[model samples]
Target: MTAQLEATQVASTQLDKNTIRRRIAWRVAQEMNDGDIVNLGIGLPTLVANEVDKDVELLLQAENGLLGIDSLALEQQIDLDLVNAGGQHIIAIEGACYFNSADSFAIIRGGHVDATVLGALQVDKYGNLANWIIPGKMVPGMGGAMDLVVGAKRVIVAMEHTVKGKPKLLQKCTLPLTATGQVDLIITEIGVFNITQQGMELTELAPEFSIEEVQMATEADLIISPHLITMPTPH
Candidate 1:
């Protein structure tokens, strides 16, 4: 490659540190409607709460009991009582309330959640997910992932393009399965993909990044949607 092309490529990738994650969150939020109750999975999924528009009355629900809240910036000190499903310290919004874990599961299992955003370890062409384990290791148990994936009306997954620089979205999952073909969407740093019957279809691509570039970033054979669009730039 010529030095000029290299420079252009480098400059294009020089996006805001949290731009990709926030973009994923923003897009996911766009799928939600007013008064829609949401359940955010641990990790990147939880961060979605912070990226939503303030005016959007998107109610936030937690499997660990809290509901109708927003994300709070972490402070030096922590509050043991107020935490996320991941057990991270958090602050409660004004009208936030809590309930029993069993009741929370019931809400999820009963399809009370309008939408759920979750992080995944692997997602196949057919939308199968493997987010609960790392093969041969069972230390971290599957919390409410199973319930949320199957119960929610829509399941959106937020994750990096790869793990340890390896593609997690594959033609077939090798990791212990979390839920079989339950994902509706997969948002990565490079693009937004949707799981279809044929394969993982690219719905949106990052700025200046082509569908070919995104395909190169993954080991999976990513198929671009016929109506693929470019992700909107942040203001």
Candidate 2:
């Protein structure tokens, strides 16, 4: 291919990736309810903070003992001490409070948190999550994920449809499990899956992708939702 064509392909790929991430974040944000206390895990899940509607009364929780997080914009000066679980600088909203890790874990493990958005390495059809370890690959140990997953009323996963062209949505998670059968919902670049007693249901799809494409990319069988619809994309 010509240099111009190669450049175009690279730009297109980047744009696609960005669009996918934004869509996943937006969908996860829509799941938030007014006055809900939510914890957002590191990585892709953190992006949901930006997509949340300003009017929504969500109290963002950080595992490191901060609550009611208000993410700062690019131009804002970040306070070194005010960081989320991902260690990204953030601002505290009105009524925000802080405590020690003991209190934080109490809030999480005691089931006070309404919801938690997390990113996963692999999620099986049975809603099993394997996010902490990737076999031989070195990774930060699973922090409060296990506690949060079991404690939160709702567990939503936000991640890419695939990793390095390999499917992350699988028949069975090959990686070590973080929390077994705990995922309530999953938002990926190509679609949304709702985990029910029956199994993973494909409830929504990206406009640019087809059901066949999604099925092909997914390793597990997907139950098509009767009310399947196109996913909302960024304008």
TM-score of each: 0.87, 0.92
Provide the lowest-lDDT 10-residue window in model 2.
1-10
lDDT of 2 by residue, 96-212 (tens): 999888999999999999999999999998989998997888877999999999999999999987765667888899989999989999998778999988888999888766777
Candidate with top TM-score is: 2
Clashes by residue pair, model 1: 128-181
> How far off is model 2, as Cα RMSD?
4.4
Cα deviation of 101, candidate 1, in Å: 0.5
Maximum-lDDT candidate: 2
Look at candidate 2 and give me any clashing residue pairs.
none
Per residue, candidate 1 scores C-alpha lDDT tens digits across 144-163 of 89899999999899887765
RMSD (CA, Å), each prediction = 3.9, 4.4
